[model samples]
Target chain A: MNKVMLLVDDDDSLSKFIKICVEESGALMEVKQVTSVDKAMDYLQNKGEFADKSRNPDPYVMLLDLGLPKTSGIDFLKRLKNKKEYAGMPVVILTAMESTENIRNAYCNYANSCLIKPFGFEKTKELMKSVTTYWGRYNRLPDRAD
Target chain B: MDKDNPLVLLVEDNDGHAQLVALGMRDSGIDHELIRVSDGTQALEFLHKKGKYESSQQPRPGLILLDLRLPKMDGLEVLKEVKSDELLKDIPVVVLTTSEAEKDIAKAYEFHANSYLVKPMHFDELSSMLQETGFYWLACNKRAY
Candidate 1:
């Protein structure tokens, strides 16, 4: 089955470049970009209009950005880890926040992985390629229920 | 064994992650033969030779690259299983995932996961990490046959 990769970054340029590179890599990722944490939840849980799996298939992996409007990445992680039902859901913190403190806190909250977002487009593309290569194709993620 | 092949089992769900890891391993030039399996269930199957893996496949994977959050079974569960089984317990299982959750980290050690790696997203960084990881596991550490 084909896989879905979800990203919640407000940066349009970064997201576009990442999407293009990811597609070009031939990994078969259906990239979903949401601007906010609420939308992220909506997409992941298939809430509201996203209920249609055809449009919003539950992602095999989630690359979450730390900074967001209203709710922060840490807050989202707090909520996500708190829920026992979604334990199988592995969250990768893919954000620009690259601090040891942030890394410590994010890990404290039970995030599956924390990735410091790359700065340059080329660097970002390389990061995206490697991350997907390891987790998506090489490593086996948790299986889907459906 | 590919004459000089070192067995490594990788349990990760994402395809992109797998590709980059492959590249990194190649860059490191370790000549480690990698085995890919998705989720915890298949991991168990591979270790035990159940289901599609039915035994008699030469030497077992020398090391395991385990992702913490897996479907059907989580990494912790699989770790516990690997550690518990006397036949497979001796082999090393490395917990390599993106999460740095305190509880998860603590729990991984508690379960006796051999090593833990929080994956770097950038390719260069990841390559370096793979170089280190591959070297440490394949070269530095001694394993039982």
Candidate 2:
């Protein structure tokens, strides 16, 4: 099975970079991108344009950016985790904010893991490779019943 | 301990598994100190600094590798307590177990486990998994503290 990763970030360039890196990392995984928290919710719930479950499979893991235009990523994380249906989904915080407070907030809101967005292209690639290799190959997600 | 090389608290009842973890960490070459507790009660005591762990100079762990089937108390119970505690909630807790049952996986995640990894039957695979786990959690994942 091709493991799908849901990437929720507003930065188009960064998201694209991550998608390329993940694909190049040779981990049999797919990156599905969404620009905002609302879009992410829609994608997860298979609402609106993502109504086809076959085309839009549930992601094994979600990489959420804390900064968003409308609904903040932290708020979305809290909402997603609070729901029993989405509670088991792993949500990894991929953000540029390294503040202890922000990291604490992410964890307090039940983020599965938190990673700081590394600087430089080489560093980012290395980080993404590790992220993909670990989350894609090693981590186990709960079975999603259709 | 510094963030680069933080203490790792390992809660596993099986001595063989604990030794394998030690070997795996050594093989991974990640600089970390592994503190092993045979039961869930001891694990909590170490984390909470109660009983024999009080006044000890060991630094707080940056990561916890928990086994679900633990003696004295269940690993899920320990995870719930740790994650619910304000002081300990931020520390990453990865569920390392042999069981691949869907219910256990769901319950561990529901309790806010940082990650869930099943132990492979093959020795080499287990070691490799441990190596990957150590590198990812200790070196890759950013610490809150």
Candidate 3:
């Protein structure tokens, strides 16, 4: 079976760019993009449009942006980590913010890993490749069943 | 030898695979010490300083390359124990194994393994994967502890 990825971000263009890049690389079987933390939660919870598990299987990895609309990424990270059911889900922080405070906060909130999002196309490609290769091929993800 | 560089503990039963990993780390451009253990029991002994390793002066490994299949105490058990421990939980445990089974992957992550890597089929790919891993974990990643 093909691996799945869930990308949570507010930027449509950025999400689109990543979708295109990741799809082109063929690293993930499917890349599900959601614009807000609420939508992401809904999808994960199998509500609304994402109620269909066959179409939207639980992602093996999640790329979460720190900056979001209603619920901030850090807040989302904390919530995800606190939940008993989602404890095993690996959440990698992918964002433009590179400050020490942000890094410390993300890790403190129990984010699995934190990476700075690259700006340039080539750099973005490299980052995406690394992200997929590291998470999909290398990192062992927790089973959604548990 | 860079004395100040963070140490890595590699646990693998296959001699050939362990040597390849050694070679990869040696040429990885990131200079650091890599300690090798042949089985899961030795890994625990080295970590807990039990038996012959009671007086061993080796420092706590900043990174651990653990194999799932072993002679005694499978990798999952080791991971569960390590992650549950107060002192050892902070250290990153990267599962390096040949199995790509979903169950294994799920179990490892559930046990809170820091990362997981499957051995590459080709020599060059293995070396490259090791290079990327070394650079990412050792050079870039910020350790919690």
Model 2 complex DockQ against the native? 0.66
Clashing pairs for predicted structure model 3, backbone only? A138-B116
Candidate 1 lDDT tens digits, A9-86: 877788888888787767767688988889988887789868887767777668778888889988988797677555
- Which segments of model 1 are wrong by more than 4 Å? B1-145
TM-score of 2: 0.96
Chain B TM-score for all candidates, comma-separated: 0.93, 0.96, 0.94
Model 1, residue B141: C-alpha shift (Å): 22
Candidate 3 lDDT by residue in tens digits, A1-146 = 57778999988898888887887776755678898999999989989998988878778789899999988999999899777678667788888887767876776566777777767666666667767777777665554562
Instruction: Summarize candidate 2's per-residue lDDT along A22-45 as a digit string, tens digits.
Output: 877777888999999889889998
Worst 10 residues of 2 chain B by lDDT: B1-10
lDDT for predicted candidate 1 compared with the true structure: 0.72
Q: Estimate each model's TM-score.
A: 0.55, 0.96, 0.73
Q: Place model 2 in a CAPRI quality band.
A: medium
Compared with the true structure, model 3 gives a TM-score of 0.73
Every candidate's DockQ is 0.05, 0.66, 0.26
Candidate with maximal DockQ: 2
Writing each residue's lDDT as its tens digit, candidate 2 over B27-137 gives 767799999999999999999899999988999999999999998999999999999999999999999999999999999988999899998989999998888788778
In candidate 3, what are the lDDT values of residues B68-125, reduced to their tens digit? 9988888999888887776676667889899989888877776777677888899998
Give the distance in Å from residue B12's predicted Cα in candidate 2 to where it truly belongs.
0.7
